[model samples]
Target: MSVPAHPRVTDVIETPVAAPARPRHRADIEGLRAVAAVLIAVYHIWFGTVSGGVDVFLLLTGFLITGSLVRAMERDGRIAFGAFWTKLVKRLFPAGAVVLGAVLVMTYLFFPRSQWMTVIDDVRAAVLYYGNWHLAAGSVDYMADNSAASAAQHFWSLAVQGQFYLLWPVLITLAGLVAVRLGVRVRRVAFAAVGIVFVVSLAYSLWITAVEPVWAYFDTGARLWELALGGMLALVVHRVDLPGTLRMIAGWLGLAGLVSCGLVIGDSLPYPGFASLWPTVAALLVILAGAGEAANGRFSANRLLGVRPLTWLGGHAYTLFLWHWPVLIVYLELTERVRPSLTGGLMVLASSFAAALFTTRVIEGSVNRVTKRHRAPSWSLAAGVIFIVPVLAAGSLWAHSIDQDRRLRLELSSNPLAYPGAAVHLNPELAAGLPDLPIHPDTTTVARETIDQTRSCNAVVEDTEVVSCEFGDPGSDYTIAMVGSSHVRHWFQAMRTLADQHGWRLVTMTKNACQFSSEEQVYRGEVYTECTAWNADVMLELAELTPDAVFTLASLTDRKEDEHVPTGFVDRWRLLDGMGVDVIAIRDTPRFDFPVPECIDRNGRDECSSPKAESMAEVPPFKDLPNVPHNTRFLDLTDSLCEDGVCHGVIGNQLVYYDTDHLSYAFSRSLAVVMEPQLLEAVGQAVPKGEPTLVDAAMTLHESAHS
Candidate 1:
């Protein structure tokens, strides 16, 4: 490996394989760190934006650590991975633990019971790492953007960096060993190997971001190129002895690039792709500029970055990053404000700085100082203690929540009064049995019965093709096709009993958060291509199978009836009408910002009911949007679902909602009494007169095909 004459902080750790390199005390790099932290905090708090600050951090992580690994391998013919990791734990863990412990306390005091389980899970993921994967899976879910932001979401990057820290050493060790076997210089082999990773990973980033941008955002595989770019630079930067004037100009431009990041590159774009190169490369320029003394001269921007205030901020940058996000998200949720006012933003910034300064100085710096003076085992033991305490506390919280939820579910099944799912509709006498407050079978268990969580034939977000699930009586040839998204899927439970009793087959095709629309819908700021593709296939299949009638959602949630129909609803209605097929368009269930069931669980029934008129369209959307008048029938079960111009959270002793919008399976099934009659009336009215009813027509076609 080619060696740098100058020693640096990353190089100075006394691992067994480490050379006796002294600390370089690079002021410019520290200054860059300060700038990065400020930009990220400013964007997160006030701008409500992404500024590519995480991109810079990824680059710096690879740049700083790779130099030391190379030096260690050269000095001892191998890297001492254990000592290297121990040094990182000492530098990173204490501040993170202090902030997480504080977040837990604040969460208990300020957050609602509805959000408790969410934050607890995030806290655990934050402590253990894998928060990024947890978040990626959630980000595209039907319920993803509906909830408030998680306080610990930024731990995703920290998790990514931690993963990189573990994996990089192994990769570098292998590269070094292979190079030795091949008689090639270790630096040449390492750079080439990392460069290959950079190209392949960048291509994967582009593809995944294009297809599924939400997952791409936090995916470690998609982000590998940014860190690999830094590794490649570490291999080549020492050889770049640029002219003093050119180096000075380059440093100034780099600083300008970093400052302009948010403005030049929009926050909406999927990142860690080609656009990320701008920030990573800009950070590289500054790192490279100050590689020697000439780039830190009066003319260079490195001199400005090396100023006292920035250096001080840079010194505590890690802690600041840890403290700022939770501080901002918790403050936003508690205040019930979307973003802060000018004064509030200042308070948030001041609060973050105060927390960061304390955690870093009292806990982190002290741990680093003590660990430096002590042996690796002492620091390792201390790190374990720091991490374990929070985990035990978080685990206890989770355990209690689980036990409580299970009790609630048990009460639902065992107690007749508590578990009167659909009885309010069956016997008017039992209507008096429904309790008005404090329902059992809490929101979490009810939420599990949602189509998304149950993972029945309901296709999840990742599905790209039609997955048809059959319900109802198989003995009947009278099939009804249910299409669109989860909004339509919730109707399954209501219609399942009706279909079997009526001797109709129900074929359902649904996807998560992806309603059928002729105009492409957006997911994570990109075209929901999978949705477009799946909808196309479903439309094609339904056209061929021309069932008795198609049942689907007829209105968008939270919009006036006349304003819109789903973008493609009209087109599909026309096609089906052309095939002499009818559509039973169900006016969608009402939506709420607060889940009524969870609200009832935490608050009383009186406080939890949503207004009837405001929750759904003032009129059915398809009523105003043109559709096949004779062939399309509109079903509004809203009356049975609501009463007294108000919607009850629990109807017929069934929790109305699993989450904010979707119907609980129990509640929807209960609606079958109210639904089946209206379903018959609407669908019967839509079938063209003189045409054989679907049952007669289907049987004739089958008999003829067999004959």
Candidate 2:
């Protein structure tokens, strides 16, 4: 109720403000969907980057599904949950199943053997509608960008959409249940719940994107608000109407903004972050502008959007989205192309479009026809179950079989004669036939073998302080603190062997990407704030342990990109020297940008070697450290790993760098024969001499993995 307008305005009685008018038959929404689907597929192909189109789809899905379900419940007094869900499954699954099945066949025929297990694992996740989480766990991992890109990676959005389809209805049902119990309207209850989620999830997305972008990019929690924002618009638009002038402005602005969002945000942002509002808001305006027929005749965006071609694409959008990614991947792999040349990308796009058209028409239409013959909701529901169970089971069985196969390969690698490590360096004959074909350890294991080190001993990411894992003669009086990033940790196999022979206690206190230094280091694409703090904590702990000597790589390390000393190494050396802790600083090894196993598998040994000078950092030797005690010594071991200044991916029969930079455990262990003497000289300086190391030089441990 409004107070009577002030008497100053004259004595006209005021009336209640009416709600905006609602319109039906939004052909423009369909057109917007077509635009979004094309942008998403096109951007993914040509630019090889996200184009903010997925965010638009997420919102559109949220709004359409929520609005439809809410309207049905309101009109019929209760939802036909079984019928509703079955209809949705029928519309979506057949197309998705077609794509998955095709990809599986393609994987066997085309993808590298090393990628088989990873893609199969993703297949299971995709079928179960948790592909996003699976990807979040792997792709957003520490040093995650290093993993080989997967064809199924694009399934993450589809999975998010599928999960939302199941979850949102249940949420609405529960909201209705609560509303009845409290004697309030269901719409009010549902809206309140949705509004609450929007606030919480948006806040979480903002915070998580800022802190852990890898996780944020694929996290369901971080992306939920995008869908919810769409749902909210569905509710608002259903009850409100805008005048002609307003709709006209929104129509033109929304269309232009929708097409240009990718340009504004670019590829640098950790999105669906706060910047996501740009696309979602633009989509909302499009929906608003499309509410009813235009008052301005040809001026409205809806006129163009409602045209024939766009609406047609919108009808087949789901199939197109499903088909494009795998098609793109297969085309690239078969052509052995990277980031697709224009002609190749065009071929991929055309193939995807053709596949989409076929699946949507034949498989999708046929399934709908069969399901429609039965009007009973229960029959359709059972049919949906029958259709889904077998598909999911097939994925699970394939994943298990590949997992068992991988374990067998790893077990076989353990045999002394079977998998040589660095001995390949000593015997070039070992890598003779490997370079001519595709050979690799499980591509899935690359991250574990590289950054995470996969050993149960490494500290978790949450461990901000030093957490030590002991190895080799824990009771020994002489203690050696093995420290550095994953690069340093890769030497554990050799270090463990050396410590055993000398009766020395070995403690590993390293973190992912953490280097022992006083200078700031980068982590996850930003300044590595956590690494700097962790390094400080580690230095404090080493001071307390007062170990005989700290074994760590001392020189600046460079990979495919830049080279630099961890600016704080000098400060750290001075502090350690003052504490009487002598340092055994080893010159850092060369880093290869590409995976050695993958390279060696495809190319000859000669072709797989990286230039030594280009890969190595040019830091000064420890003679530059003015505070060095007489006991402190520096060692350069580059010659042992390189020949003629070119580093082989496989030296002897053993693979060198696992993925790109990190040495495999096997290769590092093979170096025990070489490392034993050098370490003996360094540790022998302080501790009473012990028995010599007994490593077999002929059977060098060669089992290594790469970055």
Candidate 3:
């Protein structure tokens, strides 16, 4: 792949491997830092967008630190790992601790007890540098559901960078030692190391972009390359000499590119993949332009960067980065709105800046100044650990507390729609009770056999059960498969009921967010490896069985436009349609208008009922456009599920949904009545009419389940 060419400036200066003792400051570098901070703030504030700006910062961080470390190593003939770790601890920990502590305090005050657990868990994950994994597991259908606004969500990036720092120095030192042993210069080894990591990271980026874009966005595996690019630039900085005029052009263009990246990239882009090169390359240009003899020049360096306001803001950028996101998230949670109007946006921005300034001056500044001047290396390290450890412990304890509370509440609350005389029926009693129903003897017997077979399907896959089920009969003639992501699994209870009534053998081959398409990878983290393999095995297995019918909720094709997931519903339909098997595509239900967990916590269970027609009255039409292709028959229950242009709370007096989006078992069972005609039509087969006995049997089963 070609590195997109940009205009270059030239100036030549040769210096020894060791940097001078004097502290070197460049106006352009500070300007670049200001540029980066502004771009990210603008992107988050107005766009709520994901761009490569974060990656750009990672690269700049790598370049600056690596350049300093290499020069220090050359002077001393050995790197002081202890001193390096101490400086990093002092630079990062104080601001991070203050912001985290503040966010926790705010969370305790405004957030509901129900939400506190997840917040606590997120805090713990952030502290442990594993927030990315926590997020990746929940990545599927992420757009449809709103997240509880949390300040700590943004810390995942900071954690990623911190993790990189933790490991990179050791690797660099090892490479340096090997280079000396082999008679290769340290600079050359550094260059090679950067190049190797960059190539591997890029390859990983492309693979994840195709398979698991969400994981690719967060995973350190695919992101290290951006930092490596900066490290490589640091190693070669002394070797390149650009002329004055070219240097000036490069500096301005670099600034222009940085600004453009913020403005032009929308929320829909596949981030941190190829798109990230924009900001990373721009930062590199700015760094290169400021290098060499004329480090402070008219075009390459400017008095504007050194102006009091810019420099002051630049000095507090760390605190600002920490403070801004949580404040915005918390404010949104309290207000119940996210997209602020002009005035609201300004308020958020101003408040964020004020908090950032306060935290920086009052907490971070004092700690850093005192630590740097007087603290020993071991003491500084201990202080950093002490500050971070409490937040992690608190977060973990909070998560556990929330889980216990929810379980207790659920146990105490009466089932809102539980019928007056309904009793839990065991399998043998249910089988015995079937004889009193008015139905054909043949159909009844078949239904009973199907019910017995499905008992094994629902059996929890323990060690022994797994082995037994592995070789269980992959039944033919009556096989019905349920396939898709976890969203589809939400409907399984209803489907299982119908399968029992119809005497159909049901099989489930589902993954959390994976589509049934033959794509290589889906989702993020190590889970994608398992999800992809599972999907492939399921598809191949299904092909062998050639089941009677395969059912799944309609594909969320709109996410394709945003590059959120690879395969669309139309693609999946086409693949199944070509296989000479019947495919049933069920339309997805409406998501709650507000964030579910937060709304439930705030308003109590009364306000947490199934979405009714009145609740969705204001939602725009065309938001749920039926975009599936003509080859597939789209099954929409919107009318049956809603009434008077608003979906009602019930199907025949049983609540229609389990949560905000999933259909309740009772409701799905009732849906067989509304769905029977369309299902018969799609199957292109007719119920054998004898004495109306089968219809009576089906209706009786449906009513029993719903009642």
Candidate 4:
């Protein structure tokens, strides 16, 4: 193939040199795909780390697709965007649809009903090729119902690739158009556009990964730079004809770096940031080395990578990637284990490979043959519609059923006689026949009952700005501020009942996974800088408002099977006492390593309670702390929440803690009976203004759910 010539250089009059042409076929690149797939599976299953294999795949997609688009644009004046997209849909959709269908069945069989709605949303997101954004949004939103990792979660990377395919060609076509008008080489313009993307996306990736690594992990913008690096390489790879010896050395060095990236970085650094350059640049080196034949074939990285087994694995790599995660997740769910044993992990790997081989040959092969016979875009479009519509329809129906079930459960809670909640602990009559009744806020729907499920009031994982929600009497003269993390916010239902009856305004200053403390806190092994800033803003807000009473948690279990009041909590209370604001410090609830509701649902509630001695100290730690604020009054309702030595999953037929830690809103409302008198005594208000009953509270909860 004759290469495109650069326009004449005015600085010196010389004949235009022809640019090197990219090869049409590279067996070594196919082998590289096999390596990436293996790394991804191994890291996910055995190491619990990101292998940087996804980054390598992103780079390869950028390189190969850009090369294909540039060639097409050079041959024809413009890219056939419709034909290109249709072909992509035909090639990718069939395998994706098959995997989704299999995942849906696996979820129904092995996963609980409560998790169905989340996985269904994942399915829809995958179908629309927006799974990355969907997962990113949910990952950061602490109160989101979709917190549990779904079987289809791995679709996020494929979704990123699909989005790249949709956008990259258009960018190159536009660059080519501008190049024609400007009378410059198209490759120069294309390279410039890709270079800009590389710099901008890399900067954004570094910023977001540092501040909100969880979201950055699945963010398309954070990952675009990896792809752009590959695009840049494709544009110039042919122009650099390196010496064979240099190519051999670069090849080996790049492969070694690529292999070591996961082991060295392994779950330590926030990803897709500058750290990602290790794997992506290594991939670039490999491609640069293999762009031409080596002087010594035996030692060339390309020669080793191009072995028949690797190339074969590369042929099935796409399906292999899709099959692995769902298989691992289903295996874990069935075994009731967090992670698989070594032998089990090997079994998972073998099963994934087998499934991938079968899927690639049967589903993908059939689609490929049909598309080959009928090359028209319409045929491809029809193929895509055939594969996608059923999954969407099934997901929609499943989501609707979940909503209906939740509404039914809420209605059941409206009757206190059936769902007495914490009241039964005090009233023996309410406890009668409770063992035979159905649990309200059904275990399946309990996880979704977070404060943010109904309203977006608290700051999310990455946000530093203060977001407050006002409940109870907004116009009341007396104010009761609920301040802290979700722990403090979880008690809002009980506080709301008190606020309404006593004519006191209720305000919440809360952030997800952040407590109201002055000391630095660590979350997920990183300094929660956003939480620190949020705590500062909250303190300033409290000083300005200086409410009559400031409500917050007095102690924490610290997830270490022990409870205590940290020195930071005492400092904040003292500051509040200085402001003449009375502090209503409530004891924090028990922290669990596993989801309580899920445990209760899987095994009967009788088998699910944790021993009180295992979760809390014999006495409240805050009561013994030195330098305790004189104005701060403590409330211990642990007896009302846990029975005799055990923290029960269900109290009075109402599920207590929703997930592992936060109390269910329905159960929290029921605790008003125990909470009201303590709150009144602490604030020096008349005891129990209107004496609100649990029945009234239940009705209020039903109304709130509708609202």
Q: Which candidate is the best by lDDT?
A: 4
> What is the C-alpha lDDT profile of model 2 across 1-707, one tens digit per residue?
87965542111212112222334777788889999988877777777666678899999999988887666555554566667777776776667777887777888787655576677777778877898999887644321221256766778887888888888887877766676667666667778888888899999999998877777888888889999998888877764557888888888898888888777776667776888888888888888877644432476887788888999989988788888888887877777766677887788788888999998888877767776787676655654556567666776787777667658657766654445555444444444533332122344454355444435666545457777888778677789888877767888877887777667888888777777778777765578777777788888888788888888777765664544445476667767788888777777788876766666545655578887778674444554656555656676667668878687776644566776777876677777766765777776643345533344334343333211
In candidate 3, list every pair of residues with a backbone clash: 9-246, 9-247, 10-242, 10-243, 11-242, 11-243, 151-326, 613-646, 613-647, 642-647
| Clashes (N, CA, C under 3 Å) per candidate | 1, 20, 10, 0
TM value for model 4: 0.92
Per-residue error for 541 in candidate 3, Å, reads 3.7
- Per-residue accuracy of model 1 over 202-272 as CA lDDT, tens digit each: 99999997677778888999998888988888777766767898788789888899888877875646565
TM-score of every model? 0.85, 0.87, 0.70, 0.92
Q: In lDDT terms, how accurate is model 4?
A: 0.81
Model 2 spans > 4 angstroms off: 1-23, 139-147, 292-297, 375-418, 423-456, 459-463, 559-567, 604-606, 617-631, 685-692, 696-707
Residue-level lDDT of model 3, residues 1-707, one tens digit each, is: 89967632111112224444533576555666666676676667666775456776788788877777666555555666787887777677766876787778888998765355456666777776776667665452221212344567777777778888887776666666766667666667767877898999988887786566666777888888888898899788776667888877776777678778856665455766777778888778777777777654754543345556777677766766777777767767677665555776678778888988887787766766767677688767766777787777776676566556545433432331232101112122332333221111111022122233333433221111110122113442466677776456655655665555555677776554556666654343333555556555666777787876777765342311221223445566666667866777766555554433344446643465443433333332323545544445546555665545544333332334433455544445445545656666665656665634333554455457657
- Comparing 1 and 2 on lDDT, the stronger one: 1
The parts of candidate 4 lying over 4 Å away from their true place are 1-22, 140-148, 293-296, 453-455, 687-707
Task: Kindly provide the TM-score of model 3 when superposed on the true structure, using C-alpha atoms.
Answer: 0.70
Question: Candidate 3: where is the Cα deviation over 4 Å?
Answer: 1-23, 50-52, 111-115, 140-149, 239-241, 299-303, 369-374, 413-480, 484-487, 494-505, 511-543, 546-592, 595-597, 607-659, 664-707
lDDT of each prediction vs. the true structure? 0.74, 0.72, 0.60, 0.81
Pairs of residues clashing in candidate 1: 518-568
